[model samples]
Target chain A: MKLKLTTLALGAVMAAGPVMADLVFPSLSYRTGPYAAGGIPFADGYADYFTLLNERDGGIGGVMTKLIECETGYNTEKGVECYESTKGEGALVYQPLSTGITYQLIPKVTADNIPLHTMGYGRTSAANGEVFSNVFNYPANYWNGASGVVNYLLESNGGDLKGKKIALVYHNSAYGKEPIRTLEELSAKHGFELMALPVDHPGQEQKSQWLQIRRERPDFVTMWGWGVMNQVAIQEAANIRFPMENFIGVWWSGAEHDVMSAGDAADGYKALTFHNVGRDFPVFHHIQKYVVDTGKAAGAGDQIGTVLYNRGMYAAMLAAEAAKTAQGIHGTADINAAMMRDGMEALEINEAKMADLGMPNFGPSFNVSCENHGGPGLVGVTQWDASSKTWSLISDFKPTDGDVIGALVAEDSGAYAAENKITPNCN
Target chain B: MPDQFLFATEVFINGLMAGVLYALVALGFVLIYKASGIFNYAQGVMALFAAMTLVGIMNGQVPFSHIINAVFGTEIHHFGWHVPAFLAIILTVGVMVGFAWLVQRLVMRHLVGQEPIILFMATIGLAYFLEGVSDLMWGSEIKKLDVGLPQGGSFWIEDMTAGLGSENFYGFFIDNLDMVATIVAALLVVGLVLFSQYTKQGRAMRAVADDHQAALSVGISLNFIWVLVWSVAGFVALVAGIMWGTKSGVQFSLSLIALKALPVLMLGGFTSIPGAIVGGLIIGVGEKMFEFWIGPLVGGATENWFAYVLALLFLVFRPQGLFGEKIIERV
Candidate 1:
């Protein structure tokens, strides 16, 4: 009885040990709802990457990182609620992952002095950090994706795309409508006919759109779709016997789930990507050993190399690197949200850094500055091989039409600054 | 023929095919509303659950594996055996039947004499609950549902009709899956009509739907009839799920198809199966035709609201709906 009492007392004391102060990154995830299929793998990826860092590297700069996951169900209102609730938990950065939610949280995060990273999807003008200081969309944006698609087509046609009829079958929402302006500008520059087809939300029925596609027979079809919309569009494209090689989709539309349903017919479907494809990275090996093998995986461990999973892991890596930068800049391991923002603004990702992080050539090297939150806008192209059930990067990370994109970004951000009655300045 | 005219005709045919699918989804609502006064908002979620259950059984996936693994710290995901699609579908039907019985026992029986709004609210609550339960059971990943149904455009029809159009026009592109859905929906409607008109249990169901108190006084068990109606609705939901799941990968969005059926229900009236069909056809063709015609002028994407607007007009003009029984109350 005396020995048992002593053990109990020791166990109680150990169990009630001091809580460690860590860098908090709030992941506004949607693991259930209409978009849950896409959300699950991504959320899993994000959490798993942080877990990898915790297990493998003992966290960034010897300080542990805590990911506070709040379910948003892909709803804007719930996303706001998540932000409001988790913002007080010492969160250093926010990655909402949804454009609708990102748009809502922009002002809120700015007000709270937390850095918001939208990655590839959000307000393109936020790339103009002069107007929107708190928001950052690096490596690529929708305009970059649109320019990439056009660039790939131009390359295929031997640098000439005049008289080519390209159709844009897009989701009828802000996220989908984003590329229209860029494509329209590209059409004027390259002399290609651009037709925009809008598919309603939860795009289950798209017979009419596909039927029109059949009738018109555009030279190439570029889709800006998400979730069920992507699957249905791919299936419909397959059904109409559209040449799979001629069909291209945004990164959001290119995933294993989107084309797997169509079987072999989805072969050769192309999508514009900003990062490398597949599980060839050295970091994945470490992740497998530390995260999956240890049963600390954020998901089923089956999504380790999947596209969205890799994207999520990439996002987490960027956040970690930024945190490391903050630690270096502040001369302290412990960093606050404001310090994180400064670090993000000063962050630079190069080939050497990526190689050191074990994700050599995983993505393009770029620098984020006070004036430019978005990266070099370099994009790559990927092709789906249905038989092998894999996506292979077929094109190198190449520059987009920065002249047109820059002008548009400046114009839009300028208008935004004017409307908000704010002085646009790097200071 | 002019290319524009040929395109319009193609759109009309596709619209008819699309209507068959809409009617298939709405049929479940009509069945439940006819048998009971309660409008089941969970009908779409039922379809999602049924599809996920079917896929899970076919793939030999362990149900609630995510939760089980989380709690036990184990990594058991599958059963190491894949069930044949035919048997898996049968098993799924059995599960849905069990679900119907559970819903009747746990939910409907308690709300027997409740107001219509209360029952409706109960179904809305059931929708969220079933959605969460389905996600927990299936792991919330998009699953491909292939019951060996034919897919892609009908090549024979495309080839045969290509000559009838302008050289630029390829042909009428009709999906083989849509064709299968139409046939299945037709067979289902015929079978339902025959069962309700001929079988003794079906007669009991109709009698109960007519006047629950009167049917109870005449030896018909309200509990059994409600369970039967729910089971039939569950079967309808399964069929709709299979069709839509095959068209699009089975995912959480499968539950939102119920929203599409609402306008169908409002236009068809909640009590008539045939009305559901006609209403579905009208809405489908109207929306498609309107989108094909006036959508471009208005910047396209008119399919979402066109059906609701037409249904609203119907509600204002014909509250009982076409083919619906007109209610008469004596003061």
Candidate 2:
């Protein structure tokens, strides 16, 4: 009887062993509350991608990967609470998703020695790895998006925007305000007239702003909006008969839901992006077969090919690659948060690696180093085909004006370093 | 006319249309507050719930499919049959009426004799509860709501007024949706006025609003009247929801439109329906004008707070609002 009890105890312990995962990636997701529409698919994609890796390749570096999702509701306080509560779970990295939460977590992650991947959103200056040692916004950042819009316009306008008028309808928050400074500098360089229009949070009411747009009649209108604001602005633009082709939004504003409500009126609307959209890649088939078909999707299995889903999957793929790099660097499958940070700093993404992972030309091929955590800030443009309900990349992931971005990054990061009393050294 | 004057004229016209939309939301709040001395904080959530229900019914989405799938490991999403917009709307009204009855039985009955603050707090609780329930029922994804309402710019108006302004001005830009909202709001107001003046239940509601004790003494069932008023408010919310949801896709942010209605309520007086209309129009026009003329001087986005400042000034100068009942004391 004692031997039988011993065997039972061992079985119980083995049953609980999978609960303590080898690698933990805490997803600060906002699957509830005001931003849930955007948050749901992204969270689903993030979790499903990791599930795919585990089901297909037995996780990163032959050890199983675990994703711990905590709902933040896109609120800063809730995001911080989620981070604090989940940081003790041996969290390898955090993708807070919200720029407000990113600002709050930058110092916290640095203090805790956990790597933070803000992706396309967050403080653009965090690109300076010398000042922000733990935070990584690789592949592309917001400055690149702003410059990318200008470059696309320049190409369309026959390489001259000297006399063109551009209006920026931006969310009156840090995330929306991010592109203004860069756009201002670019406007000065390219000699295009720039007008700034601020839309408050939860921007449901915008009669005055749209009326102003209708009155002023800017040659081009670029929006830095998200959530309900994106749909509302697009509808209002359609209402004012704003030429949909001339209106461009950042990646956050260019999702399936944003233009679906406006129907065919939103056709030809443009948006800047950092990654390829649609489910044409081979990885999605594996995800469908392994994760979704097995009834293990993080959300409804319907979110497979959406823009936000693809972006979320891309984020997870980058995280997994960084983990693989970490394992290669330390020569061990078992690594910690500090090792993850080092791995993120030394990571690289080339075309061959992307194709090997079945995500060829999925994103720009960029490298992260000790001094540059943001990679070469390459950006592309995508236009919506309302009839097909799809977003196709219209421009290649081309180079942004590096000289201007470098100067702005140096100025912003230098100020940040002075404020925090941190030495500007990659070491 | 000069280009600047024509632009201001266009802003004014748009502001009036925007006010009508705000007033539509305020009408729901006014009805509840006038009948029961309780300020219904859940008015916005009611609109959100109604919109979600309408969309869910129209799309043939299985309610709580997300939860069901999660618990039972099922893959159910839709019923594979779409309900027409008219039938879906009728079904939604029935659901909202049922909801009204439930609220009266489960919530308002328990707090019948409570203080106004207590009743208001209960509504605050109801708001959150309803929001969660709506999310569970419809799933929180942003769904497109189309009841065949007109959208896009009114090219007729643009063409008619194209010659009124300078060459740069492309005529007064007006949305077709806003024009429909104006006509619908006018008809609603007229219908409400005739109902309260002619119908027996409407008279009972007004009597209850005047003196609850007196109305009870006259053999009026307070519970029935409360449910009736709530049902009417629910219908109003549905209309508001359809208008706003059709403009901006049905989502959680639809609940925040109640914040915009608060200034309208304060300016128009919580007990008066006509006051709600006038207040909505004034607040809308004032904010738009201020944002246009003065927002550029300051930073833009003054529309969010400008209404409150105008309402505050009204409060300081005339506490009872434009059409609110004037209080008197016998002491």
The candidate 2 chain B region of ten consecutive residues with least summed lDDT is B165-174
Q: In candidate 1, what are the lDDT values of residues A1-427, reduced to their tens digit?
A: 9999999999987666422378899999988888887888889889999999999889889999999999998899999999999887788999998999998988898788899999989899899999999999998999999999999999999999999999999999889999999999999999999999999998998988888888888999999999999999999999998999999999999989999988898999999888888999999999999999998888778998889999999999999999999999999988889999999999999999999888999999999999999989999999999999999999999999999999999999999899888689998
User: How much is A413 displaced in model 2, in angstroms?
Assistant: 0.6
Leading candidate by DockQ: 2
Off by over 4 Å in 1: A1-20
Task: Give the residue spans of candidate 2 off by over 4 A.
Answer: A1-21, B70-74, B328-331
Give the Å error, residue B228, model 2: 0.8
Alpha-carbon interface RMSD of model 2? 0.9
